[model samples]
Target: MNLYLNLPSYGTIPVVNSKNQTPNSNVLTQITSTTSPFITKANGNITIRQSFWQPVPNVIRYTYKYLGNNQFQRLHTDPHSNLITNSNFPDTVFSNSVTYSGRLIGLILESPHEEEYHSILTSMIPIAPAQSQNATGGVIDREIEKLLEIFSLQQVAIPKTFQTDEIIHIVILNPIPYQTSLFHIHQRALKGTYCTLRNNVWKCIWNIPNVRSDFHSVLNRFSSNDILINCCTSQLQPILHTWLQNLPHTSAPHLLKGHHPSTLKMKGRWYQTIN
Candidate 1:
C-alpha cells in the first residue's frame, strides 16, 4: 500500500526522539540505545531515506503514530507477514525521504522483517500561519472545498477545530477492499443478482442467503453503463451511495463491470441503480 500526505506550506521540520529531544549527529547511536524501534519522524513534505526491511521474525506488528497537540496520536497499525495472503499484506520494504522544496517526497516504509524503525518527528517544527488570500480560489483549494461540501452533504462529521490550512490530504492507494471477513462472506453469499437497462442506465440487484454459509459462486457480469448503488450492504452502502451521488459520473468499461463473487453478499441483498 502507498500513502501520500500533501501539506500546504513548506519549511524546515525537525526530527526528534521519543523524549522529544533532537538527536545528535549520531542518530544510529540514539537508536541503539532505545528499547523499541519506533520512527521519530515521517514528515509528509520531506524525503526520508531509511531501509525498514531486514532479516527478522515473520510475525510482527508495526504501529505508526504522529504528534498532535503535544501528544502522540496513533495513525495506523499494520500487523502482517508473508504468511497471510489477504489484501492488507504489509509491504516487504519501506523508505521515506522528503525534499525541502516540497518536491521529491518519498515513501514511508516499515516492515516487521527489519530490526529497527526510523522516523522524523514533526512536533518541534514551527509552522507559520499562511498569509491571507482573496476570495479567488486555487485549483487545489477548490478541490478541498468540494470534498468538504461532499462530506457535509453526507453528514460526515468534520473536526470542530479543522482549518483550511491545517487540512492534510492523504490518499491511500489500494485500501483494503473490504471491511472484515464477515463482510467479505456476505458478498460471497449473494445470488440471483442481475443487471438490466432502465432509462438509459443500468440497474442491478443481488439476492443472497439470509444466513451465513460457505457456498458461493463467482460473479463476473457487469457493464460500463451499470451502476452498483443497490448491491451493497449496510457496511458499504453509505460510502458507495454517497460517492455515486456526489462525485463525477463516469461509464466504466464492460470488462471492469464484473463483481467479485466474494463481494456479493452485503446486508442480505444488494441493489445497484445506475444513472
Candidate 2:
C-alpha cells in the first residue's frame, strides 16, 4: 500500500511508509569484524538489550493543578455548529506538547513523546484492508481520528475564551474519554496481532475508530506520568531518548503550543504540533 504513483512533494497527499517492514524484531546484533578496510569497526554502536521487550510508553497522565470544570467553561459540543468556543486554551496557549510533558524528559524514552492519538491522527491513516475494498465502511480511519479530535476538544478542555480556572481557561480531565476510546480503537494500527495470522495480516490490521493526539494529551495533562522519578522509572533514558529522536517526522508540524517550567533546561530544536 506504500505505492508512490502520486508525487507527495507539494503535499498532494500524505506521504506514507511504503516499506513492508516493522520494528517487531527482538534483535541483538554485534559487529565483531569489518570487511571494509576504509571503515573502522565500532562495538558501542550496537545496542545490548537484555530482552526483546519494547517499552509500552506510559502516555496517560493524572497530574493537574485542577480537575474537571463544569463551572464557567462550556463542556458541551458546538450548539449552532462545530467550532472551538475558546481559543486561549493551553493546547493553543503554551505552544509545545502542552504543559503536561514538562518534567517527562527523563521518562520520555519509556513513554514516547506523542500520544497514540497524536501519532496516528496527525498523519493520514493507512487504508484498512476492508475499507480499501469499499465493501464496508465509507470513511477512512485518518478522517475519523481528525473528526474525533475536533469533536472532543471542548469536552475535556473548555472551549470558552474565558473559563473556570483561576489560572487559565482550560480544564484537565482525569480520565480522557476521547483518548481511551481511541486507544481501544487504534492502539494496534501500525503493528498488531490477531488470534490468527494470514498472508495479508501485515497489509490490513490498523482498522479502528479515531481520535486526535491533542485532546488526549489534554486528558493526560494532569496525569501522574509527569513527576521525574528516575529511581522508579528507569535509568535507560539516554538510549530511549535516542530511539525516539530517530522516529520519522511528519512533513508539516501542527505548531502545537506547550509551555512548562522544566523544558527550558533542555536543548535542541523545539517542535510544537497538535499531533
Candidate 3:
C-alpha cells in the first residue's frame, strides 16, 4: 500500500520507511491492521483520527489549509477532546503575513501559547522616538492662553524679578470661578512646585531649578507672565486690570493693585503680583 502526504500547491511526498526505502511487510501490516482511525483523505486536506496503536501521547494536531495562491488558514484541535479551539491568528502576525509567506505557518501552538507568541512578536516591532518635555510644555502653554482668550480673561505681565531659579510667587487677580480649570492647565504646562487659592485669588510658587540651556537667554529677556501677555490681545488688558481692583481687600498689604507699580517694590524679590 502506497501512502502520500500532500501539501496543496507544493506537490506530494511519498511515505516511506525509516531508511528512505519502500515500506516492508511489517510496516504494511501495522498500517493495515491498526484499528486507529487515521487520515482517510489522500488530498491536501488534513483528517485527524484516534488510534490505540499509536505511540505518541497527548499531541495536538494542527492543519494548515491553502486558501488561494499563497494565502492560508490555520485550524487548531485539542488532543484529549479532539475539538477545534482558536483558529484566528494574532492581530500583528495576521497583518504582516499578507505579503510574507511562512511567517505564521508553523506558529500554531496549543492553548496558553498566545501570550508567548505576543511577547516574541512585540520584540520584533519598531519603537517610536519620544517628544521633548520643553516642546510639550510650550504646546500646553499655548492651549492655556487660548482658553483664557475664549473665556475673556485678563492676561497679566509676569514680574521681571520672578524669572530666576529661586522660588517665584504669582498672583492671579480677579480669578474667575473656574479656578480649578486654570490651576490644572498651569500645573500641566509648568509642572509648578505648589499652588493655592487665597482670598478668591490664585497664588502659586514655582521652583524650577534645572532651566534649559537653550531657554536661558529667552528667560532673561521675558518672564513667564510677559510671554503670556504677549500672546494675548491688547483689548483684554484694561478689562483684566479693572477686574483686579474690584477683588476683596485690593488695598491689603499682600494684595497688589493693578494701577500702581510702586506698591510692588515693598514685597520681597520672590513675591510677584499679576493683575
In angstroms, the error of model 2 at 3 is 28
RMSD in Å for all candidates: 25.3, 18.8, 34.5
C-alpha lDDT values of all predictions: 0.21, 0.22, 0.23
**TM-score of the candidate numbered 2?**
0.18
Residues 208-231 of candidate 2 have per-residue lDDT tens digits of: 112124323432333332212111
What's the lDDT for residue 44 in model 1?
Answer: 22
Off by over 4 Å in 2: 1-53, 63-158, 162-255, 259-261, 264-275
Give candidate 1 regions above 4 Å deviation. 1-223, 226-233, 250-275
TM-score pick, better of 1 and 2: 2
lDDT of 3 by residue, 1-275 (tens): 55443323223445443344433444334344433333343353222222211111111122333343323344343244433232121112111112222211111011111111111211211111111223311232223223223212224332322211222111111111112112111122212221111111111100111211211222222222222121111222343334323433322222122221112232221112233
Tell me the spans in candidate 3 whose CA falls farther than 4 Å from its real position: 17-19, 35-275
Give the winner by TM-score: 2 or 3.
Answer: 2
Q: Indicate the residue-level lDDT of 87 in model 3.
A: 18
Worst 10 residues of 3 by lDDT: 105-114
Ten-residue stretch with the least lDDT total in model 1: 196-205
The best candidate by lDDT is 3
